[model samples]
Target: MVALKSGLKIRKLAATLLLLGSSCIALELHTDPAVAVDPVDAVCSNRMTLSVTGNLKVPYCSNKILDQPDLSVQRAVIVIHGTSRNADDYYQYMEDAAKKAGKLDGTIILAPQFLREEDIESRNPGNDVLFWTNDGWKEGDSSLSTSSNPRPAQVSSYDVVNFMMAKLANRNVFPNLQTIVIAGHSAGGQFTNRFAAGSQEPIVESTVIPMRYIVANPSSYLYMDEKRRVAGTVDKFAIPTAQEKSNCPNYNEYKYGLEKLNSYMQNIGVNKIRSQYAQRQVVYLLGEQDTDPNADSLDKDCPAMLQGKQRFERGTIFYNYLQQYYGSTIQGNHTKVTVPGVAHSGRDMFNSDQGIQQIFGSSPNHHLNHPTQPTYPTSTSNS
Candidate 1:
């Protein structure tokens, strides 16, 4: 009898251990490190009321409020997020960059979140909160209107930046603010490139508070003309051949080229847009190692392909095109910065010494003095 009781206890112990082991396996399957967490799952903590066509709320992450006055604030860096709509993460990146640069005390970091229709459906942020189609915000398209979220007015994504600039330009609020830098990576980079060209906000022309645009590693660039880089050529450019144009009919559209202008861009004439872009302080920040042709997020369409085979090639070609197009006029206002051994990383790009100088350096020509190329670990993820 004693032997049978001992056997039963051992058997029960074994069953308990087996059950715990199965639970561990299930947990491991659920928490696999290989599966990336979707950034859109996280929402920004702060909201700003934008009075564009009408009053509407937009989500953003900022270290300081624009409405409140801070005497110590000297510079404002608005870092736009990538396709993930992860403004909170981008805000942290810029904040970390500012801390490393020793500009944390006086620099204000802002990351505005551009929500998608799905994000709105899942999150149910509010009825009046602005949201756009998955890719529309990148092109400065109007926010969407649905039955649940009836629209008071159509608001362009670029108009949000315009409103923010006006707020920053108000002397009563940011009396000491001297410079405003609009910087973006990936899809955000595309927005900054086009916005720099097409934004007609008069506050951008304010001599007291000068604006600068940092376009880093965008998939495609907005060309001023139909000119595209010739195949196998370093800097040479030509209009697409008859055969090439036939293969890709809409290659010269608004996002890739200047054919069909959007409502926001339509308001500003082509000549004025090009002239303003040439005069603006612009930086083309490229990663030396961001040359992967098969990058997961790289735009594989014909229009993007016409620019170059990969991100690094496209960036260099665009800079060269600008040099050829604008000549001496762009010399002082525009510059290209290549970060060594970094690939498709906003954190590495913004935290690099060159990026810090571009964001925080007091001298107007500080970016012209290129920093020594330092090797960094390659990042394969999209920025």
Candidate 2:
């Protein structure tokens, strides 16, 4: 009996030690090692994973404490990644911009990774990460169902945005957060623009914090109306030409226009979305020299061609188009900055003087009487 009791005591001690070790590991995971030591180190370390659904968890990198955000942080920037789904690179770009603006310590930067189906299949991760089909998430498509991980209740990519925003809006989670900026480039730019326009829950209504959007060099924009931007015109919108119609019959459908929206957009009407977008603060960052018509990711589809031959032209045309249609509704809410020599590069665009200023330099007033002037910086960017 004595030997048996001693054996049981030893086993109990071993179990206690294991639990204590696990607790330490959990504590370590919550606290980023570099944050309190150095701002640059803080910005680059401690990427986190968030559970968005019962079966889905998304990976995100952040500068703030994942478990307990510093109350001193007043500004938060969520940087979305492009087609490559290289969110880590995008996060670094935001960190670099924050460093330039000298807002590195006071800002909380987040970059969420939206993986592809293939990415999961190849890795065969036991913990499921939220994923969308190739380019499907760009349009805020619902998460794809797979054999390894089935989502009976589908969640859209925009839903992830809603989730994160809601979390930030909570007073308990982010007591000092005053501003939140959503910015993206390339395919991510496409996501940000559309998400700004079509999100069912307007950020203003949902959160007390001021929210802004930065759309940089997207291949296309979702027109509020059936009209398409005519190339070479400063402000003109019309139906697609004969060739365009013949080639891209579904040009005005769903993502291109609001014809057949996905599950996430089904509840809201297009006009409501347009009105909400017009009232929100948005900045268009265009690369003045991003005029490459033949770039591989330039959205060469027929629907995209209706916008412009190149990204720079399309951005200008869209700005004019929005001003014409929305009239004064979007007057104080929209501004466009043209970056002199950057093109289709998130690193270059966000690191530029204008990029740093727009993103991290200053915070816009919640109520704007007039739109801020376009930033024209002569300094060169080394991205």
lDDT of each: 0.76, 0.71
lDDT of 2 by residue, 1-383 (tens): 00011133565466557757797763553332111110111112233334433545666777766457568888889899877676667888899999988898888888877766655654443345666765667777776666766654455677677666666665666778888899999888999998887654443433456778899999888888778876567577887788768888988887778888765565557777777788777899999999988775677767777888889988988898898888855768889999998877899999999898888766665521111221111111111
Model 2 lDDT-worst window of ten: 33-42
Q: Show model 2 residue runs off by greater than 4 Å.
A: 1-55, 200-207, 241-243, 367-383
Clashing pairs in 2: none
Question: TM-scores of all models?
Answer: 0.83, 0.79
Candidate 1's residue-wise lDDT over 198-219, tens digit each? 7643423224666788999999
The whole-model C-alpha lDDT of candidate 2 against the native structure comes to: 0.71
- Number of the top candidate by lDDT? 1
Q: Model 1's lDDT to the true fold?
A: 0.76
Q: Model 1 off-target regions past 4 Å? A: 1-39, 52-54, 201-206, 363-383
